[model samples]
Target chain A: MIRLLEHEGKALLGRRGFAIPEGALFPGLPPTGPWVVKAQVPVGGRGKAGGIRFAATTDEVRAAADAVARLVIGGHDVRAVYVERRVPPGREVYLAAHVDRDLGCPVMLACPAGGVDIEAVPHERIARVAVDPLAGLGDEDAAMLARALSPDGPPPPALRRAVADLYRTLVEEDAELVEINPLIVGADGTVTAADARLILDEDAAFRHPGRRAIPEGTAFEEEARRRGVIGIELDGDIAAMMNGAGMTMATLDQLVAMGGSVRGLVELHGAMARGPDHLAGVVALMASLRPRVLLFNIYFQFRNLDTVAEGIARAIHAAGPGGLPPVVVRIRGVREAEARRILEPLDCWVTDDFARACARAIELSGRPVLRR
Target chain B: MAILVDARSRILIQGITGETGRAYAARMVAAGTPLVGGTSPGKAGQAVEGVPVFATIAEAVAATGADCVLSSVRPAAALAAMTEVFEAGIRVAVLYTENVPVHDAMRMRALARARGACLLGPNSAGVISPGRANLADLNDARVRAGRIGVVSKSGTLTYEVIDGLHAEGLGESTVVCLGGDPVVGTGFAEILRLFEADPGTDAVVLVGEPGGAMEHEAAAVVRTMRKPVVAYVTGQRAPPAKRMGHAGAVSGAGAEATTAAAKLAALRSAGCTGVDIVTDVGAAMVAALAARRGAHAS
Candidate 1:
């Protein structure tokens, strides 16, 4: 999911025929008296994190923006802030169009209780209508959602159109989720989206054409993406690399079960096809973590294991003798004899047994690092 | 006698002219698993490893009477390829392509269900009824046809399960990969139902991972099944909100059932012989099968 910042989500909503509070990314003020200054972070609970501030004057806007910029909420740095024209105090509502995986359909969710986390709201309070993708949103769907917003009488005109438009945006924009929290129904009866959260579908990039994912995850993960492999950096001491995602998780589970902590994890996504040099690069990336021990648990069927063996051998040789941490490998599958022969001369502990190799890596990690 | 596919099913490659398609074609021919025909849009009337290639799935199905197809198209062509496969009235279509858009998957899944056909995956490793029909990523030479049916999300984990089963002198009656996507065509419940009814399958081995309510849903079906299920859900120690390689493997906020511990516990409560570690899967299956036999004897 490509999580859009508050401003970005609003930009998408605004362009797609929704009335959004006039806003600009911080440092530039929107033409208005009182403004709601919000920290542009991907995480939720920014309001409670002291990431939100309201300012009535231009000078106050700048001050609030500066303060929010220095704040980090949910371990994410507030790289920017969004300032928008504040809507007058009015009725708060929670509205969202999301893909309901359990139902295998798109659903428009409307709740009268807004401003707070929608999950906390009782199930009976929310109105959820599943929309047919092929047929698109219809009048009956809009009417049902509208009734949720205005139980006593006719819904505000802004809402009657918003439900259908919201569902349309989800389908056309290829978004997994489009949410407007505290969709304010002002005293003047105008509907305003004060806050928005849009999660674009990453796989829909083919249709979207230039929608780049805001680079997420740690530097190791980013590097892994660049290298065409998958890497996740965690807070641990043992660094493990595996041939497949399932193996990666199973390896992580095994290590943790044995009381071993993993600082780095790498999955050789297409490394086998890319050959030894690419795998060596991934190994080098793992080695940079300065882990206590490096563990490679790789299993193959049709693909030869020698390619990975050579890659490890290359990474070890490239690191030069005594230049890297302790290494343990558990590799077997097709061409096991050839794979073992390739890694025979390396100083690393090589075995075909998964448990023994994991145990060895854990034991070595307990020892103080000799090289790093 | 296999659940999804067998020696009788005529399997074709949707993008047979391409590199991956050609490789699958060659492997299918080598395995002697009903190598029928394929489609390449422009490369009609060609042959890859003795399998005939056509202009489209419709033409391939008409010419060779193919009821099943293994698609190996690029990501951009993944959706269109499945659309053609489904439109041609293919009974079973295995979308071997990965990175397909979620919307496309939803559409194809809906279409498959509407047509009452089975769609394996958008990121699927494919399926194989060992020694009968080999459509999966697993080496055909390595696996043998047996009574235990295997179903999993990850192909690599399936590899481990297959090896464990082999170590225990067990072999699969059929292996179905539900793909590693957040939303795949088939789920654990569907496959478990098939295994329960399959005469070839005496017991089932369900390999699950953290992320998605599919495991819990499968647990619902396991409660009614007479066949014993040995379940293993990985990623118990996976960090929060982290996708452990697969697009779908994550225990995010509010997704309580997607966590490994929760899924495993759910399946165990459904009477599955739970395996804590993946390596213990084969032994757990042995115990579960024995328990079933002991019950039968009583």
Candidate 2:
């Protein structure tokens, strides 16, 4: 899931025929007064984290914007700030649409209790309606959601239209989540999205070319993105690389179980599509961590193991002696003999046994093996 | 007999012109998996490894009476390819493509259920009925057909568990990889039900990881099962919110549903012998199956 910044999310909502606050990204503020300076971060609970601040005047807005731009919320640097025209106190409601895994469908959630923490609200106050992927959100579903949010009386047509539009944005954008915390119902019955959060489905990037512009979280992430692999940094001393995600996590679990820690993990997404050069680059990137032991727990089914073995051999040769950490490899499947033959010259411990490879990695890392 | 595929199961390879597809086709043919035909849009009338190729799944099915499809299409073409398979009345499909859109996955899953067919995965390693059909990404030579039914969320984790089981002189009746997506076509409960009804399967090994409530749902099924289930839940020490390679293997904020400890506890409460360590999975399965046999004998 790639989280869209506040401006980007609001722009999308606005495009789908929803009302958004008059706002602009920092350095280009809206012409009017009484603005809310919000630090543009992907994470939630920013309001509680001092990421959102109110400014009464233009001078105050500039000051708040500067403060927000310099702040780091949720470990993410605040590169941009959203300065929006602050709406007056009104009926604030929580409205969100997300794909519910258990329900196996898109679900729209609405609550009369809004503007505040929706998690703190009682279960009875929140109304959830599962949107049919086939039929989509019907008029009745929209009306029902409106009524659920405003049980005291009939909700205005604007609220109903907003609900419909929200559902449309969720489906049309291929977004995993589209949330409007504190969807302000003004005194004049106009509904405006005060804050928005949208997370687009990363897998659907083929459909949306604009998704390529989203920034990576870290330098390692950026490099991994360029290399077409998934690299996550940790604080441990063992660098683990694997072919699949499930295998990567399981390897981490096994390593931790043996009293070893992981400094980083590099997952080979489409290892076969990429040749040995890519794998060699990935191995080089993993070596940059200077881990105590470079652990490779790769199990391939369709892809050739020899290519990976060649890549490992190449990476080790390029790194030279002592440039890389002591390596422990557990490779199997698809030309296992050729892979073994290729890696025969490398100064590494190679085994088909998963446990033995992990134990060896830990022992090489100087971490005490805790036998269970 | 195995729950999904057997020697009689006629297999069709979708995207057979591609590298991965051709590799799988060769392997399946070598294993004598009854590879009848394949489908590749515009590449129709061509053949890969003696297997006839058609323009559509319908054409392939008409020619070979293929009951199963192994799709290795690109991510963008996965949904359309699977739709064609389902429309052609194929009852079982193993989508080997990864990074498929969640919406497309949901649509494929819904269609599969509506057709009363089993869709293995959008990011799955496919399924392998050892000694019968080698549809999965597993090496057929290493896997032996036996009594233990294996179902897992991760393909690599399944390989490890299968190795451990083989080390203990046990083998799988049917190994199902439910894919590592947050939402999958086949869940643990559905597979467990199939394992329970299979006469060849004496015991079950559930290789699970922290993430999603699928494990808990599987535990609910385990509560009513007559056969013993030995479970190994991984990702115990993984940091929160970091996706552990698999898109579904992340523990979200305050949600214990996907935590390894919670999954193990839930399975144990449902009478499954939960192994904390992945290596101990085979021994636990042996002990659990032995306990069940002792009770039956007494």
Candidate 3:
């Protein structure tokens, strides 16, 4: 999942027929004055972090943008600022639509008290309804959420329409979540989205042709993600790879338990679909970490293990004269005999035992120098 | 006698003509899974591993009386493929495609609920009742039929538990993969209830990880279950907010409830043995079952 920056999210909301404050990215201010200069970063709590600054007039907007640009919220450097015409604060209400992972269904949520942290909002204060995956968030349901948030009597038609629009954006854009925090309800009963937080499902990248998602993680992790593999960088001496996410975590747990320091970890997702050469590239990426020991813990059920072994063998050969870090491999499961044969001639320590292999990885991490 | 799939299930593959589908079809047939027919759009009347392929799920169901389906289509086709299976009246459906969009999964889950059909993962490893049914992605040779029912979100994690179980000379009665996605079709609570009712399952191993309240949901079920449960959550050393391969495996940065440690503690407090280490689960399971048997004897 990739969380879109506020400007990007607003652009999407504006396109999807939702009322968003007119905003422009850095260098180009929106056509109106009395704006809020907000730093564009994926992380939340930007307001508390001083990433948002209020401004009036073109001069004030420029000054606010400069100040906001200097601020870093949650370790993300403010590379750009979103300048949007400020919607006059009447009542800050919150609205959102997302799949409730716990409830196992799509849901629409709203609260009268919004601008603050929603998590802090009492459960009873917030109004939520499970969106019938079949019927979707209908007109009645939207009115229900609006009425619940209002609580006095009835809500404005625009508020009800906004509630429905939020759910529509969530489904139509293939977004995991579409949240409007501080959905300002004006005195005239107009609903304006003060901020938009959208997380697009990366798997639906195929359907969205031109939409660009912000890249995450370190340089190595970004490279790994580009190759359709999950890689994480740590501060240690061993770089390990595994076939599945669970196995990867379990291997990390075991290695850490045995006093092995991990420098990086990679889950060789779709190893079979991505052939040996592609796997070799991932191996090379792991080797570039220059860890003391390189580890691979692979277990396959229907997948061929030899494909992984072949990938390792190819990486060993492709590393050329410098070779690779001291390789420790724990490979098992389907096509084991063939997989072992492929790894036999390589300069690596191969084992079928998980504990023994992790132990060996730590032991090798303690070694002084690599002979290769 | 297993909870979900068994010897009597007439299973079908949604994308049986594709490479992955064809491969699983062959493996299913070789392992003696009751694979009746499959759906491959234009490949109707054709065969993969001697099982007939239909143009659509309705045709396959009508012709073969298939009630279970294993869908091996692409992520883009995940929603449509699942809709076909659920609409065809398949009681059990496993969406094997990985990287399926969450909205698509939600729609699929809703369809499953509306139809009263059991829907497994869009990225699930599938289910297996050992020698009885081979709906799971595992090789039948690796797992032996036994009295312990194993339900996990990860097929790979299940392997570690199975290996640990082997160390204690224990095998599984039924192995169910709930899928690795954050929004999956089923959860631990529902599966635990099924295992609780199964006559063959004496104990159950609930394998979970960080993130989501699914484990907490299961903790509620564990308190009332007659059978013993052993909970092992991975990512003990996982950095918070880091997506640990499985999209659902991330530990919420500040929220204590979604972390692996907190989840394990919740399950343990509910009166089940919770182990931090993966390899220790089997030994814990053995001890739990023993204690239960001792109580029964008394």
Top candidate (TM-score): 1
TM-score for chain B of all predictions: 0.98, 0.98, 0.98
Q: Score residue A54 of candidate 1 by CA lDDT.
A: 93
Query: Cα-based RMSD of the predictions, in order?
Result: 2.5, 1.8, 2.8
* Model 3 regions more than 4 Å off: A151-153, A320-323, A367-372
Q: Write the per-residue lDDT of candidate 1 for residues A1-372, one digit (tens) a residue.
A: 799999989988999988998888877878976998999999889999999899999999999999999998998999788898888888998889988766667889998889998878999999988766556678987888988988767887888888888988998999989999989887677888989999998888989988888888899899988999889999888999997788899999888777688999999887679999888989999989999999999888878899999998999999998877998989878889999999887898999877778788888988432211
Model 2 RMSD in Å is 1.8
- Residues B69-116, candidate 2: write the lDDT tens digits: 999898899888888999999988999888898888877888888889
For A1-372, candidate 2 gives per-residue lDDT tens digits of 788888889999998888888998887888987899999988877887888999988889988988888888888888689999888777999999998776667999999989888878999889999876767888888999999878777898889888988998898899989999989987788999998989899989889886754764467766876888888888898998888777777778888887889999888887546888888999999988778999998887657899888889989989898889998989888788999988877799899878889899999999788864
Give the least accurate 10-residue stretch of model 2 chain B, judged by summed lDDT.
Answer: B249-258
DockQ of 2: 0.67
Query: What is the alpha-carbon lDDT for the whole of candidate 2?
Result: 0.86
| Model 3 alpha-carbon miss at residue A137, Å | 1.9
lDDT of 2 at A326: 94
Q: Scoring each candidate complex against the real one, what DockQ results?
A: 0.70, 0.67, 0.77
For model 3, give the interface RMSD. 1.2
Predicted complex 3: DockQ: 0.77
Q: Which 10 consecutive positions of candidate 1 chain A have the poorest summed lDDT?
A: A363-372
What's the CA error at residue A175 for candidate 3, in Å?
A: 1.5
**TM per prediction:** 0.97, 0.96, 0.95
Model 2 regions more than 4 Å off: none
